[model samples]
Target: MKKVCLLLLSVLVFPLVSSAQENTEPIVLLISLDGFRYDYVARFQPENLSRFIATGVAAKSMMPSFPSKTFPNHYTIATGMKPEHHGLVDNSFYDPEKDQTYGIGKKELVQDGTWYGGTPLWVLAEQNNIKAASYFFVGSEADVQGIRPSYYYAYDGGVSNLTRVTEVFKWLELPQAERPRMITLYFSDMDDVGHRYGPNNEEQLSAALERLDRELGALFEGLKSIDMTINVIVVSDHGMADIPVDNFLNLNELTRNIPGRVVNNGALAHVYLENEKDKKKVIKALEKSAMPIHVTDVDHKENYQDLMYKDRIGDILIIPDRGYYLAWGSALPRIRQNAESLGTEVLGEHGFSPAYKDMHAIFYANGPAFKTGLEIETFQNIHVYPLICKILGLPIPEDIDGKLEVLEPILK
Candidate 1:
């Protein structure tokens, strides 16, 4: 009787063990919907995204990092580190040595290899002999640490959301062996529209989100048809906040004598002074500004230490309160392109500090590798990189700021 019981136990355990192994090796696909707010799906538009939320787990909000801009937040999401740790502070940053500003608009201004200092998930995938692909990301084109994803595309301002989605679908359709073990897809419409028109514009925001929803639906349905057990994680870089016209800060009046370049001038402005004396001058002038602008210098070394780097970032930084934006090049009749004018531009924008609820994005995970329907309470863009590594069964780099948790109730 004892021998019979042992054999029966083996019968049950063998299949379970084999199934676990099979499930552990499933594929991972990470999607970052740029400027996507957490509540847009449930509260505002109940379209395809609404359905997705019902099927997958979601957070009330995915809190973004300080300065909550594109480059810093995206790098935080991919590297699971803060802008302070990952080394990406904003879309355009002041390089003290070069005394010039760098932004995505000019590829030459970016020190791709140096800008991104941490190990991205794709790099970890490659280190573990797994394949990875990036459709678009902060440093996808930069030769960071002498490593690049197996497949990627440069950040193109002209590419439509539909076109970008279609390209990712095509890549997903590759043969089983050729398919990337990990893949990333980015959508920037919602953020684009929200910025120009503000999130309060229901009609325009809904329409833009619906378009992205259709693309997501198509991508999901296509993957399902392939019978692939792909783990899909959807996230956003940062949320958008309203920038009122009355809130625009005048830079020239504030920094008349500061010897530095103004890098970020829209919702936020970065000032890089030439020397310690210049930094002090800029700080004093900024504090006395009538618009109520918040000022931080490099010497603070605590809250503002995140802006410190060898030859990057300015000696002083200026962050505006919620309704204000600072601009360089002297304010013209029309400075930055309004996202609401979707006629010629994308639909959303994100660069404000991640303090308001509107600035929170979505974070969701679904796959055999994840705990199903688990709601994580403690999470940020920093945790994403380490989790991606775990999903691919790779080693988590020690340099990253995010730690691997069980993802709560997410895994089965």
Candidate 2:
């Protein structure tokens, strides 16, 4: 009886002890340079980020999730789930069941927590008595899992990158008990420039690289001044590809014979039908269309490499060839208007299949825990969340799609 009682008690006690251990003490800093392609370090020679790569354990490239766009991949990095698993299936998408729309450009929709399904890192951190902070991450300001970080700054694009770096340093300067253990910083200049001027435009890309290098230089010095000893992990959501001015394939014109709409995100477009009955007509129209683009019906599952949620996409998915994008209807979203404009002539875009080299992202980590001067080959971005948890000494949550063992090779 005594042995049985002790065994029963152990079952109850062990879980609480384990749960408490999730509040780790180690500090971690995550920095995201949006649209910083894997090759940018070698191609543009950004001195500061390159120096971090040389001394740190870095990966050759990080393959982004399908629909390799900004919001999906960034949310994937935070939640450790593919966009399908996280319910952020696209940069902007409508849920058939929920009849709800989600997009990064919509501030009110972004703040609403109902759209987010998976538990993000910051929310998980707070559950374990750990204080976390974020400068301007996608889910930072949201009431995700009904919890925000101990410190968060509302996203303001007008704010300078230098200020974002200084803000992280300021957070670190707080009293140990009052400070956050995990923090995220972001910069979008690289993504902005890469899109405004085609990635192939070496002259403009060179100027953007100089600006990125200066920020990295400043961030490192600020951390040094604050005496914050922690792991610094840098990554880009996805890379960019060149989409020339003349490459616009107007889906409306080609599919004019069919009755449907194309919800486009510059690089990828999803077709929706006025009625389910029109699916056949839409597919037939696309099949015979003259546009040089890839088309797949969600019902015909065999052809797709990774279309996690078929219902989320339209009846006929339109994937424009490289150097091209889809345009539809009378008016387009303002975000894509400049890219489609003649005078703007913005050339770089990325929503290509993840298999394409142009969609690969950057990953680098430097800290006491990582092996120095180490370079790992290409890996999926999903594995990133587990590595961040390992650096913080926190347990990877059970529901996360990532595996801690996947990153064990580089850990000391």
Candidate 3:
């Protein structure tokens, strides 16, 4: 009877064990070129990347989620969920429940697992007994859902692009049993330059594109030398918009009558009121402004219904039209006696409504599992997480807003 029971157990487990051994799925490389505008490839003439797009599937552009900030969008791609659904609504938001602020530079808050909702790609990979590594991708360093990628580096901007690629190649060289089949890398030079100088600055933007192209060339050559067949997904969180810094609506001046404050200053101005009854007064003040912007309340944002956590943001949302961004209240009066001392131009900014053309991001993929010469139309950035999960053969969590069917048009 013992022999019979043992035999039965073996029969039940044999297929799973063998399937795991024979799983020769194509290795996946997830990379993000921060603020890589879809037009940058053609605009800057990035030869290597341009050639790469020709050999694989390319999305005309990717529409980011509302607020369109970096942290929110990056987390969106990783979790296959919208920013509100994933609990990262914006780059800078105050969570009244936790009394915690999510900022770009706060390493501790970023590492805090409680702030993140849903399973990031790294954590998902770990759940499937898959080893993964991330170099500087947001949320990779955090312990999400009580698990992290088997091999993830701390998020650090000082790491150069060339070094990042070199490290990936080295990881790929490891023994099959020990190597991480999934990898994520990030490059922030483009975004950095876009923020420092407007996207329209031909000289600086061109230089940033060329530098990225050269680094990508080196990465491709290194992968070839190792003779590894890899599926590479290149994406960007969001694009840059030219904000005429000289012409920003001062929120303080506009909302003087209302007992509220402008909480955030950027493409979107978050307004919080001292009382619920003051909502009407605030809306009236913004409408009175001559600037070309659309102000929405918590009830009527562009995709307000789609957000699972709509209340995370302000009651009064300020979404500026293209070529405009908001300014902080203390910029002129508090800093200097004269408001005239305020700076003139803000080069570039994002976090505007995702509907703008400038906020459109880039998505290009080429590998064994993807069809060549396929160009997909613009889709929501949330849809990208499902594609990564499919390529890695990892289970897509049912709770995510990103659907695997959305990627059918691009799949081989």
Per-residue alpha-carbon lDDT of candidate 1 for residues 113-228, written as tens digits (9 for 90 to 100)? 77677877777787778778888887777888888888888877678755665566555556556767788778788777776677667888887776677767665654544445
lDDT of each: 0.68, 0.77, 0.77
RMSD of each: 9.6, 11.3, 10.4
CA displacement after TM-score superposition, residue 103 of candidate 2 (Å): 2.2
For model 2 the local lDDT of residue 375 reads 92
In candidate 1, stretches whose alpha carbon ends up further than 4 angstroms from where it belongs are 1-24, 97-100, 109-111, 304-311, 335-350, 406-409
lDDT of 3 by residue, 1-412 (tens): 3343234334433333333333355688988999887788878878778878898999999999877888889999999888889888887776667755567778888888888898998888888877888887878888888787877788878887766776776666566777787899999989988876768888878987877787786665445434455888899999998765565667566556767555566777667666878888778878878877777898665767776666567778877667766666667344233222434254667887777888889999987788999888999988888888888888889999888898866777
**lDDT of model 3, residue 8:** 32
- Candidate 2 similarity to native, TM-score: 0.87
Residue 252 shift from truth in candidate 2, angstroms = 2.8
TM-score of each: 0.85, 0.87, 0.86
Q: Which candidate ranks first by TM-score, i.e. highest?
A: 2
Off by over 4 Å in 3: 1-23, 255-262, 290-293, 300-302, 330-346
| lDDT, model 1 | 0.68
